[model samples]
Structure formats: structure tokens, C-alpha cells
Target: MELKGIHHVSAITAKAKDNYHFYTEILGMRLVKKTINQDDPSVYHLFYADEAGNPGTDLTFFEIPNAGTTYQGKGSISGTSLRVPSDSALEFWEKRLSDYNVDHGGITRQGERNVINFRDPEGQRLTLISDETNQGVKGGRVWDHSSVPAEKGIIGLGPAKLTVQDPAPTVKVLTELLTFKQTGSYPSSFKGNEDIIVFETGEGGTGAEVHLEVRNDLPKERPGRGSVHHVAFRVDNEEELAQWRDRLQTARVPNSGLVDRFYFKSLYFREPNGILFELATDGPGFATDEDMNHLGESLALPPLFEHRREEIEANLKPLDI
Candidate 1:
């Protein structure tokens, strides 16, 4: 019943056009899916991933022009780290980010890895880590459409950093309830953050791990653009998804039961620290609705929204990806 790895990390974006350009043209990821937000159909929910749109490769954003920058504090997904192929790949990205005038910091040591931290157009914290020593997730194809060469293009997710007041409760949820094993720890470079404790599940590396940073003095953050809505973990199939639901029940953690997300089945819940977490199945993926070669080319709606497609499409802003 162990979770495999990250299914995807979803965040909010203030500008759909700018977000699309930053992710597709600048970051060089494939726009795997372009759909409207199910809860609020007016905005777009855009998914960016590696060439094949593999489970761990997804980094999605919900367009909400009115939602401004998030208020930073504890109980939020502080940053997302991406895995690149090698040191040379990191160098390539450094030059690319600089050429585009994207604010970024030089590579810094974090335990055994070197990380180049940066922010998106919307101010979402992002990091790029070199996978030169094969320390990152292995699956997922290099994107062919990226302006950046395939060899140096981003591969998959790296560490997911979570900020919390006290890690004890979340630690219990992660280790005792969810089965993540504590792997290592690294002193956080952030001023007020304590040492970050690393936790891993499945074949560990990159997307298979979460880094917990304790910041007891900070206030709770409000959700907005640049805020992570939720962090989803990968499950192999329906059986594994059911097992996780049962485990949540046994542990007395209330969760959203078996949501049919069309692309993937999902169950959402809040971890002890109030950071939203989801268990999502990997199959019936992004390509389930559209042709792989032409994904994200047009708007996609679920069965419930299909009948009102024209109305929905008219309301949503045009995305020229």
C-alpha cells in the first residue's frame, strides 16, 4: 500500500498567458493538458510535464487573475524543486534563466545536492537540482518541443518542501500513517527555518521524497497565486487508492472520497499541519482525452461539463500556448 512518488504538484497563477509562456517557452516543458477548473469553470487548469506526461513529471497551475501573491508563512508548500539531467544541464538552465531575465540564485549546496533556486513569473518559489549522479527520479521522457535541447531539458520533480510549525504531527502522519521512511536531514538555508528532515517512499529519489522544514514562529499563510493548492502523491491503481482511503479512515483523517478527476482518480485531505495532500492514481492519464501529439492544443471538459462546452469555453480566457 506504499505510495509510488509524486503524481503532480499544483499551484495558482495570476496570468494564464504569462504562465503558459514561462512554462512552455522558457521552462521548456510540454503543456500536457489545458482544461477549466472543475470547481470554478471560468479559469483554466494547465498541466505542464515531460514529453510523455508521466506521473511524477506533472507541474500544474490554476489561472486566477484576481488571486494575488500568497502571504508566506508556515503550513504551505514553500517551494517546488525540479530535476535536470546533469551539472552541464544546470549550467544550461542558469544561462537560459539569466537570458530571460528571470531572477535566480547561484547553485548552492544542500546536503549532497546542488540547487539553483528561482521564482516563476507569478513569484512561486522553484528550484532546479542536477541529477548528474542519478539521484533523481528515473522515469519520464525528455520533452521534444522545448526550445532547450532535449538533453538539457528538465526531467521530473525533485524535492517537495513543506513548511510547518512543528513537524511532530506531520511526521506521525508521514511515517506512521503514510509509510514514508525518514532518509536524511539537511540544515535549511532559510533564516528562520530549522533543519529539513527528508522522507522517502517507493524507489526513492527526486520526486519520491518530501523535505520538511520547521518554522514554528511563522503565521499561517493565505491561499492565492504563487501558493501551492495541494501536493499529490502517486498510486499505482484503484487497488492502491482504495488502500490509502482505508488507511486514512483507520487513522481518523477525514478525506474527499474517491473523486473522479477524469484524467486521474483522487482523494484529498489535509495533513496534520493543514497542508493539503492528495493521493492520485497514475493511469487513465493526461492523454486519455486528447491525442498525445496534440495535447493542450484545445480546451478539454469532463463529461459533466461536456454538454455545456460552448458556454464554458466562451467564459474561459483564450490561452495561446
Candidate 2:
């Protein structure tokens, strides 16, 4: 199949306000859209990403206000890494983290790149690296809160790193179905890990490497805070999406029926290796809400939510964005 690239990564957040502030103020990601979780309208579903809020650029969150702390185990998404321009950017980011009293650690080199690892307010593990070669799509940074300067903020996605219980099945899916290529493997200097496998989608750089770290000792993951919600891959349109659905069915991979996700259509299923995966269509994008220029400033909903806007707005806790 001809996968365009990543669509978005969805994750769970315990509190709406904390997640909002972390993505907007600290990470410097724009709050592209805010609405209720379609599956459960009582909770908020927030998206953060580059300007345009393009598919591959987004990192979405589902706010389950009353959920308990997430247990970090095996079989769940380990962390997400964002790529910046150069190693120099890490110094600026380090200072920014310190300035905001957000805890972070020193740089550790990974193959050709140097990565800085940190955690969100909700304890989701995140990393930033400097990859000058693939400086992600150029755009403006939104959410100019005092904590994070507009410059040196996140430009776009880097790559999502997953620590799997057994990397074999996952590796098969990547190469055979998803069309990912095995880039190479590297030794990890980070504590408690040995080797990491790097997979590239498109001529790899930022937002391209899907790193898999194999740790046989760890127990399987139990999703909660600090765990990845789901990772989505892009399909050209409904036609291609249906093709992917048929492919999954032929392979006997369990899948969720086609569903409307407002901006795009999507199919959800667990990979043979257990990661939650979604195949989504590419159009009727963020522009569907407000004009492309005015996205994220106000509440935008899918057609289903538009009729309930008043009720959703009233139920959601007020956010300053």
C-alpha cells in the first residue's frame, strides 16, 4: 500500500487543563482543535501540532479526568521523539525546560543524532533531537504563553519510539504491510535498554524513524497515563482507506469498522504485535472547522458535535486558548 506517512498519535491524559498547558506552553505546540471525545462526549479530546494542523504533524490527547495514574509496562508505546534543527537547539530547549521548572536530562547521542528526553506534566515520555538534514515543514508556532518562547519551539514531529515485548511480529507488520524499511540498529546509552531498531518511512530524518527498543525483561503494558494512545497512518482518501481495510480483513487482523472522525475517515485495529493502529483518510482537514487561518482559536466540532456545540462548550472546563 502507498502510505503517505503518519496521520497523528493519540494518547490519554488524566487532566484536561494540565495536558493543555503542557502542550501549548511548554512544548509550544498549537492547540489546533478542542472538542469532546467522539466516543465519549463527556471528556475532552485535544489536538496539538504544527501550524496547519496537518495530519502527520498532530499529537492528540484524550482527557479522562478521573482516570488513575498509568502503569508503565511492556506492550504499550514507550515514548515519542520530536526532531529539532540541530544539537544547538537542544541547549536552548534545555534552558527553556529549566526556566519553566520542568525536569529534564542531558543529551545522549543515538547513532547520528543527539536526543534530549523529558516527561510531560502527565508523565508521558517525550524526546527532542537535532536533525538539520530534515528540518520539518516550516511554519509559525502558536500559543505564545509566557513560559515558552515562540522561537526554538517545536517545529513538527520527529518520530515515535516503541518498546515492544517481542519485536518480531511488529517488525513483520512494518515491513510487509506498512511499507516501512529497516534502516539499522544501534546500541542504547540510555539506562535499562540494549539495542534499538530504526525504521524509516520516507528518506528518514525528523518524524520518520519509528524506533523499536526490545526489552524482554519488562512486563506487558497496561494503558493509562504515560502510555501512547494510538498511532495513525495516512491513506490518500476513502478509496485507499477501503483498500487498507480489505487488506487487513484478508490478513484476518481484527479491525474497527469504518468510522467518521470529522476531518477524516478512520479504521482502528490492533496490530499482531498489539499496538493500537489507525488508518485514516487525508482530506476535509482542519479547514473543515474554521477558515484555515482561524483554526484552534475557538471550539470546532465534527458534524455530529456541531449540533451539540452549546452543550459541549458548557460541559467542558473553560480553557484560555
Candidate 3:
């Protein structure tokens, strides 16, 4: 089956406020939408992305307040990386982080680009890299915010790196099912890691290439802060998503029953190597609630939650979007 590209990546967060602040204030992402988790209305589901709140542009989080602190282990998402236009953007980010009293590491060169590594309030490892050579090659949702100058603002997603116990099954799923092409491996600059496998879609930026590292030595990862909940890939519509669901069933890939996410429909499953995977439809998208021009400014809910807007808004902590 042909998959379009990446959708939004979702993760769990301990506190809603911290997640909101990190993704917006620190990362410079627009708080595209504020809504409650459909599965659990008591908690909030926040989406951070470009102004348009496009599928691939999003990084989402579900607030799970009482979950115990998570230990970084194997078999969980390792880190999420974002790509920028060039190394010059790193200077803006470095100064921005410093101004906010957020701590980050120095710049380091990897492959042909320079990257600056930093952690969110929740300790999720994030990087900003300058790769101007890769602009316009991939379509990105546009964000024309004054805070995010058009030039230096994030163009779109970069690869999400997964640390797995074994590479074979995951490799098979990536190559055969997901339609990712092997882009070879490289020695890792991070701790206790060796080679990293790179996979690229026809699009070549954040959502374009995903890097997988196999580390037998590290303990399995627990879900919490700094962990990726699931990575989602984009599909054109329900018809195409159904075809993918059938493909997964044929491969005996276990999956959660199809779920409607309002803006998009989703199917959740675990890859052979155990990293959670999601297949999500691209639209009817963020424009469903607020107009595209006013998205992410206030609470936006699906029709299901529209009736409960007052209650949901009351329960959610106030955030500056």
C-alpha cells in the first residue's frame, strides 16, 4: 500500500502546563489547538505545530497527571529532532533558550549539518539543525506568526529517532510496509550508541527521514517524560487508511481498533520491534473548528466536545496561546 508521509507524533506528558509551555514558549511552536483527550475527558490533549496546524507539522501530547516518573529505557522512542533552514537559525534558538534560562548543549556537527541539542521542560531531547539545502523539497504547513519570523520558523518535522532492542522486525516493517528506503547507517554521537539506520521518504526533511538506532546494552524505555508515545504517518483519506489497515492485518501486525480523532482518523499498532506506530488520515483537518486564520488561538473542540466546551475549558489550566 502507498502511505502519503508522516502525520503528527503523539506523546504523553506528566503535566499539561509544562507541556504547553515547552512546546510553545520555548520551542517557538504555535499552540495550534486546545482540546481534551477524547478517551479521557478529565485530561487535556494539546497540539503544537505551525500556524496552520497541518498534520505533519504537529507534535501532540496527552496529559497524564498521575503516572509515575518515567525511566529512559530501551523499546521506547528515544528522541525527536526538528529541522530548520540553516545553522544560522541555531544562533537564534541558542539565544532564545538562554534568554528563557533554559539550559542546552553546544552545537555539534553531524553528517553535513550543524545541530544544537536541547531538552524540553520534560527532558525530551530535541535538536535544531540548519539544512537550507532541503527547503521547498517537501510541502510544509505555513505559520505566519510575528514571533516566528517566516524565515527562521520551523519549516516542518524532521526524523524521529527510535531506539529499539532489535532492528530486524522493525527494519522489515519500515522497508516493506511503510515504504521507507534504506539510507544507510552512521556512527552515533550520543552515548553508548554505535550505528544508526536512516530511512527517507521521497520528502526530505523532518517528516522525510526517520533514524532508528539499535542498542542492546541500554535497558528498555518506560513511557513518560522524554518518551515518544507513538509516531504517526499520513494517509490521504479513510479509503487509503482502510487499505493500510488491511495490509497490517495481512502482515499479522496487531493494531488497536480504528479510532476517530475528529480532525483525523487513526489506527494504532506496535511494530515488530515494539515501538508504537500510528496510521492517521490527513483531513478533514484543523480547519474543522476555528477558521484556518484563527486556529490555535483558543479552545477548539470536535463536535463531540462542543457541548462540553464550558466544562472542558473550566477544567483545563489556562494557557497563553
Best-performing candidate as measured by TM-score = 1
lDDT of 3 by residue, 1-321 (tens): 555556777888888887777776667687777888898887888888877877678888888888666788678777777767767877887788788877688677656667777877777777776665663236354476636666676756677788887888888888888888887677787676777888876554546677888777778776776567888887778988888888888988788767898888989898877888888888888888787777777877778778887887777777653
Cα shift from native, residue 183, model 1 (Å): 0.6
Tens digits of per-residue lDDT for model 1 on 203-317? Answer: 8887798999998777998889888998999899988899888988988899998999999999999987899999999989888889889988889888889998998888877
Lowest summed lDDT across 10 adjacent residues in model 1 is found at 132-141
Ranking by TM-score: 1, 3, 2
Task: Show how many residue pairs clash in every candidate, following the order shown.
Answer: 0, 3, 10
Residue 68 C-alpha lDDT in model 1: 71
Arrange candidates by lDDT, descending: 1, 2, 3
The TM-scores of all predictions, comma-separated, are: 0.97, 0.92, 0.92
lDDT (10s digit) by residue, model 2, range 11-92: 9988788888788777778788887799988788888887777767788989887777777776777888765656777889
Per-candidate Cα lDDT values, in order, are: 0.88, 0.76, 0.76
> What overall lDDT, based on C-alpha atoms, would model 3 receive against the true structure?
0.76
The worst-scoring run of ten residues by lDDT in candidate 2 lies at 137-146
**How far is 220's C-alpha from truth in model 1 (Å)?**
1.2
